[model samples]
Each structure stands twice: as structure tokens, then as C-alpha cells.
Target: MSWIVDRIRPREAPSFSRPLALLVAGALFLENLDGTVLQTAAPAVAQEFEVAPEGVSPAIVGYLLAVAVAIPVAGWVAERFGTRRTFLVSVAGFTAASVACALAPNLLWLCAFRIVQGVAGAMMIPVGRIAVLRSVRPTDLLAAMAYLTWPSLIAPVIAPFLGGVITDVLGWRWIFVLNVPIGMALAVGGALLVPRAEHRIRTPLDRWGYLLTAGTVVCLTGGVELLRDGRPWLVATLLLLSVTLAAAAAHGMTRREHPLFVPEVLRIRTFRAGNLSGSVYRLVITGAPFLFVLLFQAGFGWSAAAAGAMVTAVFAGNLGIKPLTTPIIRLLGFRRTLVWSIVAGGASLLAFAGVHASTPVPAIAVLLVFSGAVRSIGFSAYNTVMFADVPRDLLPAANGLSATLQQVGTALGVAAAAAAAGLGTGIAGPEAVELGYRLAFVPLAGLLVIPLVGALRLPAAAGGHATARR
Candidate 1:
């Protein structure tokens, strides 16, 4: 125990970096919050718009697709426009789009505005990350990241409850309305707090790479959305098309002299292992909230506020465990921590499978809290360990790859959850959406079991080299 403490002692805190960190984090909170809040409110939006609850997923999927489409060009845009300019534009654009989203007249109009909001959101986070990386000395990078981590991580925790409250009281549109003031404040403060960078990378934009990658994500997410439309042939066609495009994109990256992503980054065994596994794990981590929110409301006869209150317990578990994350990873090591986390997450999803109309609200909340705790450990561990094993020179490309995959996983998780619910709906008959909702967890649990296999494949000391550096 003593040796573990010595192995990962805390570094000195940075001077006067709190405001900048919080500013960057606040933007991320808006981005992350908007997506999860919509999940809790999706059912209400469905009722108002006169569509199936699952039908609202296009707005969710549309936003994610926009993020995936824009991310490949984000670095180039930041470089050409400058970080401060790009960041300010992103905040303003996202705020303006929020206004459009709140006033959308129909589902089609809402999805269109959501796509615009997602494009701005795609730019917001990476640029904010660049600000923190440049502001701190190398010694303080880890500490600075801790500050950014809090707001981004906690947003999902609070959004379900917050969204429930807003949707119940003011209606779902107000969720978008509220972001207006927050974004306006952040855009103004960001100019004052974030340091201006003199040097910018004059990197050329990779147009072909962007097109292929964007095509792949769009096809995939769109395909997931189509499954609920009762068009199996179209869904199958789009899915197959997505696979082909993905393979072509990978092949193109290998052949290009200046690829969007460097080919060699995947050769690093630990980074590869972590990225691949983390995507599968994230599918569950991200999907469960969207899936469970609907299950509680549309299926179980719980009020939106009550469902949100239950989900709030997960947020408590997340905050309760935050201070312990670094020490626990240091103590158990990445491999052990990850394995145990996968086990815990799997058990949590399985617990959800056992819920029925008679399940106690208190009992469900307890499971959610426990599930959230295990998931927080897994999310923290998976996100950190990728960098631990990546070569220093390859850090940027590796992180880009990780971020892209995680984005896809996050989008796909919602799609998959909705599709699974649809399947259960079909099988249980049109009137049995609750039964369908109950059956949805079975597939999510199965998907989660996959990453455990990835965990076992790691060497015992995987990522220890980087962990030992501090």
C-alpha cells in the first residue's frame, strides 16, 4: 500500500489555471449535457410530435453524425483560423443553433438544427483541449486534465435529472433554450481567460480522408436509424455499405503520404488494445442511459421526474468516486482495474435485465448507483490507459483515433438501444413496448461482455510504463 502511494504521488498544482480549466469544462458540459438531456426528454418530444419514442433518435443520431463528419477537419480549422477565433466561433455557433433547435416546428426541423449544433459541438471540445495542453507546463498536464475531466464527466450524471425537471416543468424545448445564456457567457469569458497562441500548425486539410470517414459514420448511424423504420433491406444495405467504406478508409490511410490518421499508431499494441476495447465498452456506458431513461418512463409507468431522480443516484456514485480514481488505478494497475470494471459493468447491465413492473424504485436506484460507480471506474481507466502505452510522438494521432472511435460508439449505442427496443417491440407485439424495453438490456449486456475479452488479452503490465512515469 505504501509503495503504491509513493509510485503515484501528486504533482504541484498550477498557478491561476482554475478559471481557464473551468471555462473549457463548461463548454464541454454544454455539449455533453445537451445529448443526455435529450435522451430523458425524447419520450416527451415523441408525444408532442406524434411519433414513436424511438423515432426521436434521428435527432440524437443526426447530432452524432454531424460530430463525426466535422471532427476530421477540426484541427485544420483551428490551425487556419487560430484557437481563440475557432473556439469563440464554435461557442457562438452552438448557441445560435440551440436557439434554432428550441424553436423547431417539426421533427425534421429539429433534426436539422441538432445537426448544426453538433457541428459546433464537434469543434468546441478539441479546441478547448488544445488550450489546456498549451497553457500548462508538461509537469502540470495531468493536473490540468483533472480539472477538464470534472465538468465533462459530471454532465451525463446530472443531465438525466436536470432534463427530467426541465421537460416536466418547462417542456423539452427549454433544455435548448437554457444553453443560450450559458454559451453566451462562455464565449465571452473564453476570450479573456484562455491564453492566445502565436504559433499555429499550417497543416493541409485531408479532403479525401474526411469524405471517406464521414461517409462511413453517416452510413453506419443512418443504418441504425433505419432499422426502426421497418425497412430491413435498406438497413442491411446501408450497414454493408458502411463496412465497405470503413475498410476503404483504413486502406486509404495506409496508402497516403499524409493520412488523416497515421497508420503506425495502430501498431502500438497497448494503444490498439485499449482503443478497440474501449469502443465496445463505451457502447454500453453511453447506451444504457438513453435506453434506461425511456424504459423508466414509457415502459415502467414512472413519471419523467421520478425516472430522473433515480438516474441521479448514478451521478452521486460518479462524484463520490472521483477523488479516488488516480489512486485506485495506481494501486490496482490499469489491467487489473479495467478487468474488474468490465466485470462490474456487466453485472450492472445484467441487473437491469431483471427489472419488471413490480421492481421497487429504491431497489432500481441502488442498482443504478452501483452500476454508475463501476462504469465511472471503467470510463476513467479506459480513457487514461490509451495514452499510457502510446509512444510520445504518436500521442496526437492515437488520441484522435480514440476520440473518433468513442464518438462512433456513443452514437451507435443509442442507435443499438433503440433498435433493440424496436426488436423487442416487434416480437412482443406492437402494444408491448415495455416488454420490448425489458428485452433491450439482453443485447446490451451481451455487447458489454465483449470488452472483457479485450481486457483478458492485455499483458499483465500493460500501461505500467506510463503509470510509473509520474
Candidate 2:
């Protein structure tokens, strides 16, 4: 791992070197771009494939599920192979998968391609992050992370607008096609700028462990899908399977010499608490946007363009609030920031239940903007605090575990929203849709209570070094 650190680090700070910053920034941009660009194109893709809009959602499910399955092994792969090789391979695979997705003839084929794309996409963020952490000094780490965060936060904000424009002008295929040039540029930049690591560890691949973890994630995600589809019996069975797989995976990890995730990290109260809270927090945060799209379009009779445009409020608020996040954390501290964020986020979501066609556009926009800002503050702080208590030695494993859970939370959030929207059979058209959105937010808002409690476990100050050693 230290060898990875040495190789992935830049020789000097990149402030003086334009090419280096651009290369890293470009990689980060592509990572965020792929994460969000598909959402705006979903409806168009559904039309092209001649399926229900809900059917196109599987494309998202497949991608996230693939990411969840692949992320755990990413650090291990980097340790065994080297960061440069793994990164290059991941980019190539992602680019090829994007091409395949653009050319896919049917929904099934597109979903398959998306799964491949997801697996490839999963590698970019973590591997790039590892490279960034290794390349920069500790003092510069926050700034480097901020550089990467800019794209991830901004992409989702502008993605809807960009995707809508592309779909309207160039057709939905262009959405995936756009990645071709971006991916190519990033791959070239990475090859040139990122250093190759010499210290390679010969870690044994945990095949059984991998299967168990993968099975658990798949079954859990699939179970959520089934529940949303209203298959009560199947949902129950799948849930049971998911639980069994998770238990087996946990057992396997404990017994193995080199588990996929080190058990010791879980022993740290802050790490464990932070991860649990963050997962629930992410479920609500990620899921809410997807629900908002459906609500605005299907429920309120808004056009795709108009609905997509309104989403810009989130981006605006996110950007506006970022500068204040750290200061707010310093003032209120992490625990207060996290708890209040969850409370504010849940209240904002519940407020959406009152939105109607008669509601003023500006008022609705303000609410969305507020929600986005509060959420950004909460989530960024949660992610930051999780790593605070982690020792340097456990960073890789913790990162892998946290990344996987982040994807899982995202998938689960979307799934939960889907299930909630699926309720109410009698009402049709916009009324039914509005009811679904309303019902969905109720439970989602309630789930925020979990994280509100979880935040209490975070230390008042960073003085729990002894606690972390447990």
C-alpha cells in the first residue's frame, strides 16, 4: 500500500504545472459525468426502447449494483497489480462499455452494457483518489479532495440540463456517445501523468469472500427491487437470502488471513457509526433527487425540459453552501452539523408533499435549493468524519468498505423510492403519481431519524485516538 502511495504521488505540487492539475481534474470530471449524465436521458431511452419509463430504471440499477459489487476488490486489485495498470485498464473497459451501450439494440443489451460500464466506472474514483492521496502532501489532501469533489457535486447539478439538451438535439444515443471523447482524453492524460508503482503485494484473492459479498449486495439490491415490484413473497425470500449472504460474508472475512475488509476497522466506534449513519444519509440524499424528477414530470405535469431545469436549483444551492460547510462544522462541530442537517433534510423532503400545480415556481425552487445545501453540508461532513478516526494503515480497507456501502446506499435509496412510488393501484395518471411521491417521502423522511441518532456517536473533538485503537 505504501508502495502504491509512493508511485501514485506526483513528484511536486501541481500548482506550478497546468498539465498535471488538468489531467487529475479531467479524470475527476469524467468520473462525475458518468455518474449523473444518464438520469436526464432516462425518459428518452425508455421511448427509444419502447418500454415503460420504470423499465429504463433497471439501467440505473444494473450500473449501481455492478459498482457495489466491484468496489470492494478495487483496493486489493490496485495493491496486487499497481495503480497505473489498474487505472488504465478500468478506463479502457469503461470506454469500451460506453461504446457498447451507445450501440445496444434493446433494453436488455443496454442494461448489460451498463453493468460493465458500472464495473469500469467504479474503479475510476477510488483508484484516482488513491493516486491523489499518494501524490499530494497531507496538507494538500483536503484541497485535492475538494478538486475531485467539485466535479462530483457539479456534475449532478448540470447533468440534467446537459442531458436534456443533448437528448433534445442529438438524441439519447449521444448521451452515452459523449463519454467516448472524454474517456479517451482521460485515459491519455492518466497514462502520461500518473506514475507507475513498483511495490506490488502478492495478496491472495479471496474468491469465496468475493462471491459471498457480491451475493449479499446482489440479493439485497434485488430484494429491494422485488419489494418495489410488489412481490411480497419473493421480497421476503430475497431478503432472507440477502441476510444469509451477508452473514456468510462476515464469517468468511473473519476467518480469512487477508479479508476483503479488515475487521479491525469495524471495531472503531467512530468508523462504524460514521459508516452506518452515512449509508442511511446517502440513501435519502441520492434517492430524493430521483423521486423529485418523477414528481415534477409525472405528478405535476411539468415538461422534461422544465423539470430538468428546476433541478438546477439543487446545483445552485450546493455550490452556494459549500464555502460555508467547513466553517459551519468548525462552529457547530461535526455532531451538531450532522444531526441538524438530517433534521433539515427530512423536513425539506416532507415539505415536498405539499407541492402542487398551484404552487408558485419560485417558492418550490427555493425549497429545493435549501434542501440541496443542507444535504451537501451534512453528507460532506459525514464522509470527512468517517475517515478522521481511521488509522493510516486501515485507510485502504476502510475506503473500499465505505465506497461499497456508499454505492449500496445509493441503490437502496433509489429502490426504496421506486417501491414507494409503486404503491396505490387505483389512481391513474398524475394523481396516482403525486400520491406515490407523497407516500414515498413520508417513509424516507422517517428514515432520517436513524442518522440523526447515529450522529451522536461522533466524537465532540478528534480526541478518540485510543477509542480508534480498539
Give the residue spans of candidate 1 off by over 4 A: 1-18, 42-56, 134-145, 150-152, 427-435
Model 2 misses residue 271 by how many Å?
1.8
lDDT of 1 by residue, 131-181 (tens): 665534433433555666665457766788898788888999999999999
Worst lDDT 10-window in candidate 2? 461-470
The C-alpha lDDT values of all candidates are 0.79, 0.77
Give the lowest summed-lDDT range of ten residues in model 1. Answer: 134-143
- TM for every model, in the order presented, reads 0.90, 0.89
Best-matching candidate per TM-score: 1
User: What stretches of model 2 exceed 4 Å from their correct place?
Assistant: 1-36, 135-144, 424-432, 462-470
Clashing pairs in 2: 9-135, 10-135
